[model samples]
Target: MIEGPYFVLVVLGALWCGVAAGVFVAFSTLVMRGLGALPAARGIAAMNSINVAAMTPAFMVVFMGAALLCAVIAVVTFVLWPEPGTVELLVGCVLYLAGSFGVTVVANIPRNDALAKLAGDEDSERSAAYWRRYLSEWTLWNHVRGGAALAASAAFVLSLT
Candidate 1:
């Protein structure tokens, strides 16, 4: 049987992964749509603000903390290979670390950075074009993040069984 603290971390990590997935789902399903409906400048401004504001300590606890815990689980399982639930735990870790979090760092964040650099003037052709690209591209990666996070949660749940 897994140790108590390790198990708790895994479960908490899974819950946090679910929370991250829900955030992405909300963006894909409603938030992005609502932003898209607004005027280009306003939408871009709103999204930029959201991106900046989302860096709060609370969000970091969930996002970065979950990833950190999941990573720890991965490393521990790696060292303790041949354990009963190691495979499932490893799968969950990989999905969260690479697919969900990696995508955010590699794809979504750079887009956010680019948008942040802009003046957010929708009337400006350059800003307008950037907003258009940001909406579609960001939403697409958000879907990926959501799917990966859900998969990670499933794997973590499997590890429990």
Candidate 2:
């Protein structure tokens, strides 16, 4: 018989992955903006970076990695994609992963590193200047990353119909 539970799993996994990705983008935007709001905010952003660094390695290694593993297993479980449902689910999952990696690797980490270094030091012209630079640059990329996540989620939901 065609697999039903596995089929449901794919759809649901895509749904949840999409949701989690949207949340990540939102929170990152909030963090970026919060950091931008004040001269003293660099320390907050650095703390947030430590939060991000703590979170990302584990997420990249475990949760997102597990989702990828699930998608790979789904492909192998049925000789062909069991349904259009599966193809859409897999594509949504890929978009979520790629978009997420783009944010974390491309945008956040470098900003985090810069924030960490500057926040680690005292208030100074260079440190203040560095934070100002991050405020402008980081916020722009966060929006792009957030949009990618929103698109991924919308596609995942459409796949359910």
Whose lDDT is greatest here? 1
Q: How does candidate 2 fare on TM-score?
A: 0.67
As for candidate 1, its clashing pairs are none
What overall lDDT, based on C-alpha atoms, would model 2 receive against the true structure? 0.59
Lowest lDDT 10-residue stretch of candidate 1: 116-125
Local distance difference test, per candidate? 0.88, 0.59
RMSD of each: 1.3, 4.0
**TM-score, each model?**
0.94, 0.67
Q: What is the Cα-based lDDT of residue 27 in candidate 2? A: 58
- The candidate maximizing TM-score is 1
